[model samples]
Target: MAGTYHKDESNTVNRYKHQATYDVDTIHAIVNSTPVLHVSFVPDTSVPVPVVLPMIGQIGHYPSDSESHCYLHGYVSSRLMNLAASPPGIPLCVAATKVDGFVLTLTPNTHNYNYRSAILHGHGTVVSSDEEKLWAMQLVTNSVVPERYENSRVPPDNAEMQSTQILKMRIESASGKVREGVPEDERKDMKRDDVLDSVWTGVIPVYEKLGEPVGGPYNRVKEVPEHVRRFVDGENARRWTYAVEASRKPAPVKRVKKQNQVE
Candidate 1:
């Protein structure tokens, strides 16, 4: 939920103490907005580095009975040696994309998606705490399957934690950009028969769906656990309903009214 940091008039980077906005709502929206995040980092040394890495981690609450908050954890490189080149305080950029609608225009270049996306640039430090690392692993599980921790077995010891490396990024600058509506060329292109017919055009919506849960291998009881049943009926249902409602809501109107007009 880090707020967008504006450059000072003098053009120097501000410290973390400056008045900044990191609203919970903004952070939640950014976390759920996209399922995939593209993470990029620079090696501390002058050697050339790869520009992109695909990160698949859940950003959600811890498993224990507590208020849910956002936590991000995932393995960067499988090879332990790759971690050496990464600096302690260097900034890493994480970006997410949520395609809400499509923009079909008269020209091919104008085609785009109506999306809500977030780009966060910040420095991440390698986690060395035993307790924090265990909590991070639990957070990852809960992110993927809400309330899965309660139904599953707890992580026993530090050996598992030691195997995984966690990084906590202090989010410095974040920006959210969104676009939604019918195509910009809807009015003009509708009038042109050739332009309209040449392209098969319309909006194709995307959504996440939860299928029926399978029983765990170790479960003695044959029936699905109550937690699994409740999750399917509760959170998953609500999310889909909310997404549909958001899609149906009319885009904000920006018409201007004449001054002193009462009509």
Candidate 2:
């Protein structure tokens, strides 16, 4: 699994190399965990600067057990979507990150954050076939609001489908960087009596939680559906536990042995 992605100059982490991960599971988890992904792309060759848009997308294999791609949606006439229509595809970078805690160290220099982030670089092509396009659309819609596609009207009307466009990017290379556990203060600072007595250092658990849901007007449902309620509760509990655990301590190191027990 580690060899699935070969790290290169584009995906390698220059600083804090130990925190970098090329594992498929780690990269996929980080990418799918975040709600919004920032896609940076050049609209036209004539323009010098690239445009960054907050897009809702999902990372998945479409049609069947094929290569992984990041699926993004936007208006039909949008510049980004239009750019994806080019031959071969449009070059773009996609990024997603989640913050778990804020590490408050004794000295400001050592302060850091517990986070998980993934960056995917690839060429995005506009999905032309209606069959594949619908698959990608449903994947993205469910990601935004779980079970939304099945609950609401699906197989969108012809007009609606014509107005919306989906771009599928064939991910070439990807990497994930994660920081967990508590703060690491310098040895000199930790040994200082004055600093130990005066300063307090620890991680402040930070997590994004889903608040109580509110129904809108013209709504016939009297109570929040069980599905929605379960989703909220499950997410809140999972994230909160992750933040708390990440701030507390590191996991126990695993030991590996040689086949012949050379030692």
Superposed Cα deviation of residue 123, candidate 1 (Å): 0.8
Best-matching candidate per TM-score: 2
TM-score of each: 0.69, 0.90
lDDT of 2: 0.83
* Residue runs of model 1 more than 4 Å from their true location after superposition: 1-24, 57-71, 78-88, 103-107, 186-201, 216-219, 246-263
State the displacement of the C-alpha of residue 261, model 2, in Å, after optimal TM-score superposition: 32
- For model 2, the stretches where C-alpha displacement exceeds 4 angstroms are 1-3, 46-48, 75-78, 251-263
Best by lDDT: 2
In model 2, the worst 10-residue window by lDDT is: 249-258
Q: Root-mean-square deviation of each candidate, in angstroms? A: 7.8, 5.3
Model 2 C-alpha lDDT per residue in residues 127-212, reported as the tens digit of each score? 88888888888898888668878877677989977767888888889988888887888789989999989988888999988999
lDDT of each: 0.58, 0.83
